[model samples]
Target chain A: MSGRSERVRGKLSYAEAIREALDIAMDRDERVVLMGEDIGVYGGAFQVTGDLFGKYGPERVIDTPISELGGAGVAIGAAMTGLRPVFEFQFSDFAALAMEQIVNQAAKLRYMLGGAVSVPVVMRFPAGSGTGAAAQHSQSIEAWLGHVPGLKVVQPSTPEDAKGLLLSAIEDPDPVMIFEHKLLYKTKGHVPRGHYETPIGEAALRRIGHSLTIVATSIMARKSLSAAEELARQGIHADVIDLRSIRPIDRETVLASVRKTGRLMCVYEGVKTLGIGAEISAMVAESDAFDFLEAPIVRLGGAECPIPYNPELEKSVVPQEPDILEAARNLVQGRI
Target chain B: MPVEVIMPKVDMDMASGKILAWHVSAGDEVSKGDPLFDIETDKAAMEVESPGDGILRFPVDEGAVVQIGRPVGWIYADGEVASDPPGGIPSSKDEFRQSVPGEATADGSRNNISSGPDNISGKFRASPLARSLARADGFEIATIVGTGPRGRIEAKDVRNYQARRESEADTSDALAVSESASGTGTPIILLHGFASDAKSWTRLESNLGQRPLVRMELPGHGRSQILKAVGFPDLAATVRQTFDGLNLDKAHLIGHSLGGALLLDLANARPDLVASLTLIAPAGLGPEINGELLAGILRATRSESLGPWLKKLVADESLVTESYVQAAMRDRMEQSTRAAQEAMADALFPDGVQAFDLRAALARVEVPTRILWGKQDRMIQWNHALRAPGRVAIHLLDGIGHMPQIEAPEEVARIIEANL
Candidate 1:
């Protein structure tokens, strides 16, 4: 962990970084095991598992049948006993299939059993819309699980956070859900080698500004950062906060930025009505930060519909860089 | 930190008081217990003593109604700079710049501070943060111009307005002129007195027909910049500069009170600029003057207290209307303007006595001269007209006060035309 923080380990794609984290975790802990459909020999759907199955063999990197419910149940049972199972869901939309096991069993067993049992299961869901995955394949369901008290939900926007947060999720004694945006798989960033855990329940301030504060999650964070850059060129600056963990949301980070900027705009891929933006807006209104607001709180979230198969419609459903730019400009310029 | 001067609760159940007058001008040195200002409650008027010994600086102009315990001014130490009282409520000092919800402009005209679509609801649309800032800073929401949708006032608007006021306070010697002229030939320039502006000649101007009329707004009045001068001559020079800018070879000059003094000086110094001279209850003529009435005029911030003082300008109270009171209130909108006028007042009427003797200037001017004084004028003694040169025609009208041009505009106009 110390070496990773000190050394420059070159650039790596987000998918490669997550694979490197799985490789390092399995090597470091004997109890660590990987479970998912076609993950072992088929290199998984996105090729994130890649050649890890050849190196770790069938026992450590086990591939399950195409049953999300059964796969998630087995992963939870293994975590409850001794093995630290890392379950992979082909698409986050499939989490709806295993909600009974994930939300009721894996999330509440530790609390209901009076802390006598622990479910140290790490579930990785390829989330978000962008690649024409249609309604069934692409969805951002982090807020759903984030509402569950016993589970830890996180979304990593960069390669470094993707690797570090994965390592941390596996180490957590409670069940942790990782919502990794599929669009970010090919995006490359400097991912330091070796072990590093990005602590859960913390946010990343991507940009510091005085004009307005922007709270974004997952892929929206990346888009907001780019939007902030463009806004800077137009003489409007913004504070972009990447809420990495939604379950134990970093209230202080969001509140402090709102207080300084006197304006707030939340960008998310979840449905616009009751998504992460609603929670953030409520938190600000309920806190003293509400009084510091110079303008009304704005939300730039997904449209009120499922992800479409048409690429143009899919892009329109969620907040893009241009959407972020316009909203931020309106917010800072007092036009909102 | 400077010692704050707050409105004291003189009587039980008194929530607020109207400032009657300030005994000490801004930057004046005083010791503790010295008379600072006079405030009148519903029951009685009383003098408020100084709280500390230092240079005095009043934030609120005279004639303003202040709530009890609210700061009226500050007493800074000898070398201390006059910053506003920390966390204290700002009132008249920021009146011109800070938009208060539902506040009428200086001209008694409302400017629709909130031009938002919800204006019909009579509610100001400001973000929670902006509302918080305005509340903390003691700003009125309705007065702030919103830049957001539906004319919603945003946080930046409040901050920017505050910044503008702070910068305006630091500026000096910048003139704000309002000029209007009709008819042809040489312009007949009208100069108003203290606490008066170009608008004061409205009645007189209408009576002076078929000639160009140029109304020169006095410094610290109307839109004119706050004058920064030490002596009467310096004040005259500033007006002279404005006069020279007109590029007129010669013009008929009509002056009232302080304006009369300035015109007399101008006529003596530059005879070529004076075609004829008319002085109306002019100052710089005698020692005896109504000090209380002048102080009342300077101190009044509210129309209630100001109306009575202004009624003293004419023998009949009917001449002072609600609109006229409000128009006078506009001249006191800015605290700096009040301070500038107060400084000039102190120099001219140190103890309610005229300081300058314009008899020599009046005698030296070769232009035709005439003096109009109301027999019932309470501000200045009409008997001062006796000191004018034998060549200068003097008219003392009955049932008139200091403002002969306003009370007897037709008669004053006829006298001016006859002199011309």
Candidate 2:
């Protein structure tokens, strides 16, 4: 949509846009603060919290203990006490250790207290695979927290959206889990200045087409756009919908595209079975979109096996741009 | 002219920077390397010095996060005047931005998803998907309007649109012609071909006694409301709407000429509606159609001129009765009716050639379909009956022309009743 292509205004990397959102939110609202291990002096694992720690100072920008539970517990406690704490997980894989605090405390405190308390906690997880972080480091665990009703799951594909959605997430009364793809940190695009919200549950139509529709999430959304362009050259147009928000999936937008093209392919970096694609497929199947389908719906997610340490093997586990293109061609050709 | 100041990428990993405080305010004269502002990166807070000697100006708020390579402000040289500011950070406005303290954050109010792609909030148009779903479910999308942007039919709109169909279609709409309230059998849906209407079935009506009949005016023909545009899909959809509105799950279809093609389209679109197919001189058999005969029938205001095209309907001149010529001439005299016929002819039979192909639809038909044609039919080529798929029962009569029901009603009736 009229996103990065509006004009040649300067470009900012995904990491930079996120930092800008944090700076704007914290500066405007005194209650908003930052917390995580190695965030203050060492920046962040991916260095997303740049200069934010230094500007807000030690109290507002906290560097916690190495223990995942201890760090996550402090952030959740801060959120309960009328504070908007944005906690960063050095690696999304580390979220497993802090699940108790995230799911049980930060997510439930507002409801458990019967509306008396509000946990306006925003947790940022440097998720996804690309840099061969191996099994322990690279994992797309958004579905884990997304399954819990109390948490809102969001993945911003563009630099502009990353800034806007993160701002909205911070303002949300409930806990918002922001899954930032580690490989996407260096990607750049035009970002709007100041503070503006992209809304939490809305989906963005990245590219329009008539042949087939692709519902993509996170880095896969970016990859799909490229795949769509390549497909366009071959006279095969592919529609792509960037599923910015996962839990509150925009069914109308997805179904609308599916109806137009009569074919749908879900591209995700998470595990194929019972992942976001499964949810989307089931949603369309149950909805009226099922009747419009000319071909069986396809989902190209990661392999069932754990991410390998080898570079080539790591690339093979999750779908790449080529993989998305192939799946789109297969779906349109009625081969699958 | 003043020079623009940009946020510098201080280190390899340094992504974003914030202005903690400005050492020099706007209009403050400064030399190169002079301290301009105190900036902080993720690693450290440092004072970034001015690069040129001029009046220092700020384009961004003190606390706004400025990305690397983005213009943060401008530096004006001595004796230079500026009128407008640079284009905003992806924003096309002269006003820099609201300050952090003044910035109003979103309350996280989730807007209605169906407000369309760009937050366009009123009126609902059925999205392609909602229409496909509606078609697949055998629901008319045009009748299923939702409260989306301009009544845009989102998926929920189609589902919710189904709830209103049963009661809404029951209202007094002049389009339907179901006389005997109770359907005694699979009601035979009679669709008259081009340049014709329900009066064309007068002879067949008496021949098939006690049989159920659902007479439908294919929109804008008789009492039905005129369709604004008569495309192939639109015409098919109109008949499907009337067919669905009747609440008839299955019906035996007896279509003549283009009406036969419409039934084929309906079967292809929604095969569940037709129990048996009976096509009399259908259009899709071949691409050829007699333009002169069609144009002459619609243009002729006198029974004398209309008698010629009427003669071609049967093998013998005796079938062209004075009453038939008068009835056909009477239809052409209505200004509105003639205009609708003209539009339908141009759309359905463009440039005197049959514009549509129902051959693909023939393969989709699962019902026991039969084709009846007179060997001497002149209006639509009788050879069109030759292209009918092998499974379709073909009966080529000897003496009859195009109007098989009128020239040979007993044989046509027997063929239709046999399929039942």
Top-lDDT candidate index? 1
> How accurate locally is residue A76 in candidate 2, as Cα lDDT from 0 to 100?
85
RMSD of 2: 29.5
**Worst ten in a row by lDDT for model 2 chain A:** A327-336
User: Per-residue alpha-carbon lDDT of model 1 for B298-343, expressed as tens digits?
Assistant: 8876667788999999998899998778667755745446676777
Identify the runs in model 2 with alpha carbons over 4 angstroms from their true place: A1-9, B1-420
Top model number, DockQ: 1
Name the lDDT value of residue A101 in candidate 1: 99
- Chain B TM-score (each prediction, in order): 0.62, 0.58
User: Interface RMSD for candidate number 1?
Assistant: 18.5
User: What DockQ would candidate 1 receive versus the native complex?
Assistant: 0.20
Question: How far is B387's C-alpha from truth in model 2 (Å)?
Answer: 35
A292-323 per-residue lDDT for model 2 (tens digits):
77655677777777889999999988889888
Once fitted onto the true fold, the runs of candidate 1 whose alpha carbons sit more than 4 angstroms away are A1-9, B1-122, B138-147, B156-420
